[model samples]
Target: MAFSPASYSQNQPVLDALSRCIAACEMCADACLHEDHVKMMVPCIRLDRDCADICRLTAAFIARGSDHAKHVLRECIEICQKCADECGQHQHDHCQQCAAACRACVEACQQYAG
Candidate 1:
């Protein structure tokens, strides 16, 4: 579903953070693919994509005010944390940025999930 921040006014911060995290993860994954030792970045790339997907799903849940949003957000927090850890291990700028974004998302998700 198309996500609009205005439609989910109560969850606006969480949605905004999710959107930023998604963008950062996508960029980081693409950059990882271009790295000289792409093999070493396999985990990072995978986690980046996973985190982005989870964030997207979480946003949708929150937007719809679904009964499962808390459950989905719990999973979202885990994936975002894993992605941040993996990306933080890398020295690349994109990875660093993605890690930061994921961290922000995690905080937002936590607040919303609670």
Candidate 2:
């Protein structure tokens, strides 16, 4: 597979942030599922799922230069912030990592969206 910088050069920051957030959300969700008290991590798991989905959608919208990118970015910021807040409450390594990634995503989104 040939890599093409021209394919995504325009909105690289948003793309990079989305990719990081998606990976972080997936990792956090998997980690939460492994905890002894799965019930307690349910909120974190749910938020991770939501955040991952939105991040993917946002990236897709941006990649294609869709007219709805603005709307998607708006939603992405909210979800990322909520996910970060939830993850920040936990002391687990995965949660801490996820919180940091989500915060980074928040900053990227703000730059592009606001």
Q: Mind sharing the TM-score for model 1?
A: 0.92
Question: What are the models' TM-scores?
Answer: 0.92, 0.92
Clashing pairs in 1: none
Per-residue lDDT over 3-114 for candidate 2, one digit per residue giving the tens place of the 0 to 100 score: 2347577489879989999999999999999999999999999999999999999988888777788888899999999999999999999999999999999999898774
lDDT of 1 at 41: 96
Which pairs of residues collide in candidate 2? none
Candidate 1, superposed: residue stretches over 4 Å from native? 1-7
Q: What are the clash counts of all predictions, listed in order?
A: 0, 0
Per-residue lDDT for 106 in model 1? 95
- Full-model lDDT for every candidate: 0.92, 0.91
